[model samples]
Target: MTKSVIQPLETLRLAQYAVPIPCFVCGTDNMFDAEFCTHCSAPLALAHQADNKKVHPRLIAMVGPSAAGKTVYLGMLMDMLSRRPERMQMLARGAFSITLQQTTLAALARCAFPPKTPSEPERWNWVHCQMRRAGKRQTVEMIMPDMAGEALLEEVDHPHTYHLIRCFLEKCTGAMVLIDSIKLREGAREQDFFTMKLLSYLSELTSNDKAGWRKRPIALVLTKADQCRECMNDPAGYARTHAAGLWQHCQERFGRHKFFASGVAGTCAYRESMTEGRVQVPLRIEPHGVIEPFEWLLSELERSGKKS
Candidate 1:
């Protein structure tokens, strides 16, 4: 019954699996073909791309509550940067990176906002791009993820509920904390409280004064400012007046922080939907104050890099 046949050895394949690729977010070792990190569920494509490019990308956290428009802001920011190379150009590292921009622009083209980001770690959109200024020779590699608001709140209240959020926040070099301008203008204390809690959580991540979040740049953006004239006029003053607690907390805890107002929709109207109740639709596409905060954050990062 024994039949001997010539077979080629798979030594190369065996050797490939001998070495484990470390997860970029949580540093968990996994097989090379693993799609998501076993520990945190972050896409392993980030790790592969970084390895291939031989670059260490800095993580930027987009932190906010539900309906704060993190997705819209990030999408608009990436799309703008990708199109306009005169200021700063962003080149996506992989095919997966373009998913965020594609989905965002497509939905906006239909006069609707993108669907809510699911709370699951695997469902989050992580963007890895190389950014280069028009006049500068140096390029900065960065990774940013669109995280779900409810999940962020849960992690803030109960640490480790989402391993990806905790790991990413701890390692993030900079953060943009978005608060809904419309909600604050309507006298909602929930936005103010949630942002404060998020900041407090960030500050407690590290105890070293030199390396703590106090020294890191924080962009406190009031989104949906087109509808709030006062916010668009002066974001800092608006934050001070409307969100006193959040303003005071930032003043006390964070050292390098700035407030900026950004709006994506020119106007919005509500419409009844069969699947989802009433949904807000954009009447027109207009971006205002979208780049200033990002520009400031980049400058701060560049300065920090030079200092270090």
Candidate 2:
């Protein structure tokens, strides 16, 4: 006697239920049936449901020459994102994208600078941050390639620089270009050349790509503003009077841009007294509007996404 064969569908009737997932933005455990994060109200793992789901997360590159305080600025920005009360609701959490992230963070924690060193050809550091704003959680990733001053100068003649620039520009939604105010004050001729070359390359990239690449927003960041109190006192006015030429150049090329001042170290100088042996005395480091540019970029992205 042949017994009736059980159907394959009937054999799988006792499948186990999938477990609830935790929110990537706010760490809230969400049931499999949930749609949004319960703690932060941000959509939990629902990129498919978002408007402009094809739109990639904005990449905010921090471009600057060596010793221009790029690493310090990043450290301070992360510090602000983690502790600033005003930004608490907006910031979710920040983490390093690679092993280098922790290394950089550790160096910053000690108020020491990164080794100013790279042993490999393709070394880079990146930080990934999840931010919440207007009931939406967006990720902001920053990429900083480890390049020496000499290497950057050589990049002008090499095709790799252009390749790197193109790769970064294609993925970026916005940018913050850091200019070393102290270097400018010291009359560094190399800095002037680097700035012009970098900007010109960016302009060419945007212009050649006629597919609306120029629409990406950019911010010209003047670092070490603490050394120039007069400039910090009236940042807008300073940009208009002193940075007018550069600003105009960027505006003509990029279509959307702004100028800003930032100082990561709250003092101007530091001195180690022999009498006290290891006691470090803080000098004139003043932090003024260091995070303003980033805040503006975030606002702009939020507005742009909302409109879409």
Candidate 3:
């Protein structure tokens, strides 16, 4: 028998995947096998579903310090919107998108708040949904990620560490900055400084005057408003006094912005636990002022007809 020499494969069998897929958020081209954008760490699935040739999806971010209740507020908003018919309806795109809503509402139903979001980028939950607004011909494709507060702070302190945060801020349609109202009411100045840092960080992310935050509608959300009656009463006023730095930053830099309060817990009680030391348990599920900021942002986006 004659020995036959086989030719070596010169190219990858799946050359199409090797061509690179551009990240929708950061525009960074990544490998097809990448589950998340290599540069920004945002889910690659976003890029898969996105059709930028047509109308681009609008992205919004929920940011706050650790324990600021970003998860609770988003979860509550999703839950409330799901229950109410004829209002904004969110249809989650991927199965992963529903995880945040599912876990959040389930915890609330059990009289507990959702657990803290993990720091790992891959572990983070992202919301990709088509928001069906009443009276609108086309539904809005919305992308909102629940980012870790520590990660946000880290990015603010040291830029480029979290490319996803920077990319999102640069390309985001709007942002909802959450401030723990309970902490603010209790005379916490850290929140003020942190928010100030956040505003500055966002400002420095881009230099284009036309693309500045002046046009992006920002909503300063006072989360856990149920703990404080005054916050629920007057969120803007609360910002003016409690978060002077943030208030002034918005006034000076941002054109379209609003202050709002939201809470998922009605009344909370101190519960002693072995694993958690002491935890705050919601006595009842009362979502107050949860939808106002979202509604306001949506309306603003609708009227503006996409960011210029």
Candidate 3 has which clashing residue pairs, if any? Answer: none
Question: TM-score for all predictions?
Answer: 0.96, 0.65, 0.91
Sorted on lDDT, highest at the top, how do the candidates line up? 1, 3, 2
Could you say which candidate leads in TM-score? 1
Q: Candidate 2 on 149-245: residue-level lDDT in tens?
A: 4444455446354344445545566777777776665656555557667667666554446444467677777778877666666655665555555
lDDT digits (tens) for residues 15-39 of candidate 1: 8898999999999999999999999
Order of candidates by TM-score, top first?
A: 1, 3, 2
lDDT of each: 0.94, 0.57, 0.85
* Most lDDT-accurate candidate: 1
The C-alpha stretches of model 1 lying farther than 4 A from their native spots are: 1-11
